[model samples]
Target: MAGVDEPECALPLDSRDVRCCCLLRSFSHFIVKNPTMNCSVQTPQIVGKDAKQHTLSPTCTGASVLGIKFSDGVIIAADMLVSYGSLARYLDVERISMVNDNTVMACSGDIADYQLLKRRVEEQTHTDSLLSDGFTLSPRALHSWITRVLYNRRSRMNPLWNTYIVGGLESDGKPFLGYCDLLGVSFSDDCLATGFGMYLALPLLRQRLEDQAGGDPRKLSKENAVQAITDGMRQLYYRDCRAFKTYQMAVVTSSGVEVRSPLQLETNWEIADYVAGYE
Candidate 1:
């Protein structure tokens, strides 16, 4: 039994070692990390027989975005829809990441890439040396850092394979929201959308925005902004099967970040008049 514990090639990892493994996983790439050695062994970052070609895995897609603002507040909503190939295999793919206590990140891309981005962000949060005299990562600095990280990877021809929407309170404690895409193209707009949703869902959202002067939801309440999105989702549901009757939504404000699930609308008989004579 004692010999079994000390095998010829290696020793079994104890619970404490296993705990370190868990931490390493949460703070690392997909490969193993040897903490005692104070070194990291990166696994294959990405593996594909055809490295030069682009293949859509059942792992990506169903990426969507909906944002609303009311009373100087911003709310973002997305569905956890991960498709396997063209087939909508997984309807519950979560694209959101929590950065520290005040930020939320929504992602779209290869799931593996998304995971890598999350690990890198976690590692950043742990490093005390990176902070300025002020404690906590500055929102502007952090956003710029994230953008550069994504862009650098793309320049290496190994892009992170993700588009991102970052929402949270800034260092000055103001509500902020921004968007970054796979090519590292980033922009901060009062409203934004990505994926197929950009096509079908955005038009309706724009109309709503026009109702409030291109993203001014002060004319509307948080509840109404959310309702606008809910209504848009219902419209997309009838138009896009990839979108669900149930979706996830989030709101970011000076109050903090709030995310919800199974957010749905009552769609029983209200649209009968719209489809009455068509079909």
Candidate 2:
């Protein structure tokens, strides 16, 4: 750099090449001489107001969503908190939303992306209504459509950056629960959870399901399903950093869909005193 003039490296200015790397001998000489020196270095631009970039740092993200299928309906739950980095930015945010009369969905991750999906899905359902062919978008149909959308985005390397859980009763009155992530991976089970809930809440749901009629969701009653969801949500509040005490739950039954909000649990922190590092 002391002898050469003008830039020679490419746009990235690779440091791996000998011509680009700074010589240790030159640095040592400069250190010994203690002379003020000037050199030109190519620094790539990293920060800018780019419209195409949305939440590159993953701000305003939700935590987890849990769902289960009962004997007569399907139920899903999510906390009311949307976090901006480590700070709890929005506390009253509702992550569970109605897709149609028979379908309800819960989401975790970028709330902006979730809102975009919400509008797109609404437009899709509205277009379906315009058909007037006596056909409606069922839970499975909506889930399949969402799966394809996510998969297409993933293939383009511009994923939605969210996890979705769809729950509802199909036209035949049979309950359904499905899970899909930004990677387009999708599957349905008796119980479903996303994000931290998958690790902390899913085991409880699965155990509850297994205890009933050998993990058969159809054998589960409304009360049992609600109890399981409540228990899992409570655990998430205690364990998950992004989870909140206040949450919402949606139940899609043959009669109709009912969503309950601002639910809390009575927690006992006395057990913390027994731990080794308690102050």
Candidate 3:
């Protein structure tokens, strides 16, 4: 748990209260101060008990989002482009998650907040109530829960630093694709993308997605799905400055979740091969 200062301890609790380090201490006091008070607190999902609210703006972060569909699995690709202020920095970031035996949670945001959300979602199923009630959370539901958390942070005037694209199986065990941004905005379907991907990759994907109901890549074989997602990455690299050929790819299917980091593209880069040059 994080610590709280005296000034924060004296403020009235409300929906707009941004959680600070001292807030935890105040929270601890709340429990002690009112043993019979009924309350529920929402914490970042994956981050452990010590996550803090660092005040930062949401935009100007160079994040990536891509969606791929094939005839056994679906692939979601995100560049490891972590930006420092306006300058694009860090290329070894992997935005995809292998959270469980069969799910992958991916994100584009404040790296710390992303990790926190991942941890919380993983811990949910381990609790006795969810297991005993025979009720399990689907990828869509988890996506929704994450959106609410982001909104809550925004309400407090302190928001998580990034957007997210969550991919996994649906309640019926079918492949699912969904996206949610820092504002808690969410949309699920056969294909979806956020950030630069919404412009670069979505146009190519919608052709296949609108073709049928089972257009998600998860319905296809892993190899085909991987190829589709890789092709999309290639386009994003050529167009999006924050993206490159090298990326992290993950496939979620009935078999399991597979993630390959630092995946690169082999391309012919002869400058004048296809164009007339000054010879």
Candidate 4:
């Protein structure tokens, strides 16, 4: 009673009460400094009991990523439209990105998820560069890494909701084209397509390769590959309602990755005019 101070109140000092008192004291000081402040402590609102139970779904989505490998390099393309439901929301979205000097990637599905994946790839590439001394991830290595990442996310029940086409030249300068989807299933082919591209463009690509180069991607020239990719894109714009005429394409070779300017495919409405459903 002499040396020790009396309890602030007759009530026992509980930890919760102590915390509330400390907070009130700090708020009181803040109010003293700013007398105009409205110092009212409203009851905390309970918004939700399980915020983490919500499942993520794609809002803005892209469509139909296409890629083909040729003798000199690999070419990949995707449309610029990012759609919200049936409404075309964002135009001029670059769905294709160069991952390195010899590698490029095209993605279809959630544009936001693709952007997150792109940042992860960039961070991994930068880390590899910092640690490799001189060497960096080859096209195949990058593809494998991306596959594992997608698989891991899928296993966690939070997939990226995208299909990715990876294209580049190997360290030996051989053309490489690989595909991976939200479920993490991956494979390599002379040509690859995602989303509606698989249904609408793959046949044309395979036909072009077969007709022009005996179905061997390695036998196709750069011009042939570019033409085939552009043809596929044009067809997608015509057929795939999710697709747009404005698109971006990337050519990856041993020299480097060249992402051309966004190009618009020419369209003809004459067919629409002749259709029975035409207005």
How accurate locally, in lDDT, is each candidate? 0.69, 0.87, 0.69, 0.86
Residue lDDT tens for model 2, 1-279: 355344575555444544644565567678678756555587877875673664345678999999999889999999999998999889999999898889988899999999999999989889988999877788898889889989998888788989999988888899888999999999999899999998999999999999974788889999999999999999998888889988999999998889998787767888866778654
> What's the lDDT for candidate 1?
0.69
Ten-residue stretch with the least lDDT total in model 4: 1-10
lDDT winner between candidates 1 and 3: 3
Candidate 3 residue-wise lDDT, 78-146, digit = tens: 877777766776767677877555557777657777777777876875673456876656666777788
1 versus 3: better TM-score goes to? 1
**TM-scores for all predictions:** 0.68, 0.79, 0.66, 0.79
Residue 259 in model 1: lDDT? 80
Regions of candidate 1 where Cα sits further than 4 Å from its true position: 1-59, 128-134, 213-219, 268-279
Ranking of all candidate structures by their lDDT, best first: 2, 4, 3, 1
What tens-digit string does per-residue lDDT give for candidate 1 at 1-279? 232233255777777766766666566653345455555577885867875854334256556666655665667777766666667777666676667556777766677787877888778777743665456654455667779988987787667777777776676666666888777788776566777667887777778877765556556667667877787777767776666666788777776667887566567756656775555
Model 1 earns a TM-score of: 0.68
Residue-pair clashes per prediction, in order, are 5, 0, 26, 0
